[model samples]
Target chain A: MKIQLALDRLTIEQAVAVTRPVSPYIDWIEVGTSLIKEFGMDSVRALRNAYPDHVIVADMKTFDNAVYEFEMCFSAGADIATVMGAAPLVTIEACMNTAAKAGKKVMIDLLHTSEEQLEALQMYSDAIFCLHVSKDQQEMQGSTQGTEGFYVPPSLSGEGRKLAFAGGITVDMAQALTRIYPHVMIIGSAITKAKDPAAAAKTFYQLKKE
Target chain B: MKIQLALDRLTIEQAVAVTRPVSPYIDWIEVGTSLIKEFGMDSVRALRNAYPDHVIVADMKTFDNAVYEFEMCFSAGADIATVMGAAPLVTIEACMNTAAKAGKKVMIDLLHTSEEQLEALQMYSDAIFCLHVSKDQQEMQGSTQGTEGFYVPPSLSGEGRKLAFAGGITVDMAQALTRIYPHVMIIGSAITKAKDPAAAAKTFYQLKKE
Candidate 1:
């Protein structure tokens, strides 16, 4: 399991500062949707320049104009970009084609997507499927209330597709989830909002290795 | 009907330059999703500062963290922000509450949303329910292919909900849609991608009046 640090709701400077100390410990550095919306693709470019070796994920949560968005982010230095699972299959296919041509990767975000919707995406074997809980749902209800008991659908897991899990992930939760062995474990506030982000990241790093 | 000029897939400089000439002919200046992704909320601020009298919309297409994204855009000088209609009911409610508190407005982008989804949104009478066609769908197929004959569901129209229409709007299409008397008519590439954007906008402006 690899740890993906999600930098959300932070200014560009704060994101860079927080990641500097923990860059050596994390596998992927995610430029969260809010941060991207706050600072633009420059945030991705800045993070890419700062951590040349680390993979950068732009959490665009793109639902439309997949080709343009994927190309724009990838050219700006994103190694991986995300598309919403709820989007039409054609949109997802466009994103996949863009990623393939650019030699980049796409992570399909499965936030609020139905099981039936998940079945249609099984053919895109090269893409990484992510199980995500929306931040608004978490804020409206409680941390443990949204997407807490999500299971990877049999068709996807059985097909050996790359899988990722996100939302309110804690150190204990990460440890527990490691047994199931997702390709990427995305953690946000648990690290970025921590008193010591670097230490929190280090702990998750250790958990991933275990 | 109000003509909202959508500034999409442009650099901040390009967006500003294009709108400067056509600002007088349009009712609202929209900072499109691509612009927001490429330049952030600062793009909203820049446009707001540049066109103080005009209503500036930040097409955040917010699907989650409604309060945060809405507040960020609104505080930065957006007169209106967008939320995806495909989002959960709780999420939409949260966005409406945020907009109400900020004394701004929310436009619900109904791209990829179903008629069943449209039913749940009728309560947001003040929110503009937009009929959107995804750009990827437009490019993958032909211009006349996607969202070719979209109609406002009677459930929403009967409720006196404010309605808007988008997606590959031409001057002829705009003229046709005007007969329906939509509250807002969103035109994107028809103007922005035109050889002479200001001239294209002027033509649409005349059509809107007719």
Candidate 2:
């Protein structure tokens, strides 16, 4: 299991500063949607410059104009750009085509996507399907309630598609997912908000290895 | 009817320069999603500083973490911010609450939203329900094919809720929407991409007035 550090609600400077120490342990550095909204693609460019070897994921949560958004992010140095699973299939296809042409990857965020939507998205075998639990849902229902376990859709089982899971991920949760083996395990506040983000990341890193 | 000039696919400098001449005729100055992704909330601040009298909208297209996203945009000087209608009810409520507290407004972009979702959102009467056609849909089906007419959900009528329509809006399209009288008519490439953008904006402005 690979650890993806989600840098959210931070300024560009803070994002760079926090990730500097943890870069080596983490597989992917995610420029979260809020940070991207706060600082733009420059944040992605800045992170890319700071950590040249790390895969930079621009968590754009893109819903429309996929071609333009994907091209912009990939040009700015994003290794993987995300499109909302709730977006139309054509939009998703546009993003996939752009990513394919650019020699990059797309992570489809299944935040509010319906089961039918998920079924339709299974066609994009090359794309990474993210099983995301929305932050608001966590806040409303209490984080401990919903995100503790991995949910592999019945249709996705043994389909050979890359999968990632996100939302309120903790050290214990990370250890649990290791057994099921998602391609990426995205953790946000648990790492970014820790007293020592680097040490916290190192712990998750070692846990993933174990 | 009001004309909202959408600024997308431009650098911050270009967005400012293009709107300088057309600002007088536009009611709302929208910092589009692509511009927001490319330039961040600073784009909203820049337009706010440049056009103090105009209502500056940060089209954040917020999908989750509504409170944080809405607060960030409102603080950055956005008079209005958008929440995706496809977002969860709790998320939409969070955005509406934050907008209400800040004395700002929320425009719910009903892009890819289902009728059931629309029915649930009708409770937020003060929020502007934008009947938006996804940009990719326009490209796939031709601009004139999908957005030529306005759509208001039967449940939304007579509810005293504000209505807005967006996607491929031309001067002629704007004139047609004005007859039905949506609270806002959002125009993007029609004005921003025109050879003489200011002249194009003036035509829409005059059409709204007539």
Best by TM-score: 2
The interface root-mean-square deviations, each candidate in sequence, come to 1.0, 0.9
| Prediction 2: B-chain TM-score | 0.95
- Clash pairs, candidate 2, are none
Would you list the C-alpha lDDT of every candidate in the order shown?
0.86, 0.88
Give all TM-scores, in the order shown: 0.95, 0.96
What would the DockQ be for model 1? 0.76
lDDT of 1 by residue, A9-83 (tens): 888899899888878789999999988898899999999998899999999999988888999899899999999
* Backbone clash pairs in model 2 (N, Cα, C under 3 Å; residues 3+ apart or in different chains), count: 0
Deviating ranges (above 4 Å) for candidate 2:
A144-149, B143-149
True contacts kept of 1: 0.68
lDDT by residue for model 2 over B1-210, one digit each (tens)?
778988888988999999998988899999999989998888999999999999998999999999999999999999999999988788999999999999999999988888888889888888998888778988975644133556667877864678888888877777778777888988888988999988999998888667
TM-score of 2: 0.96
> What is the C-alpha lDDT profile of model 2 across A99-150, one tens digit per residue?
9999999999988888888888888899999988889988976643133457
Docking class of 1: medium
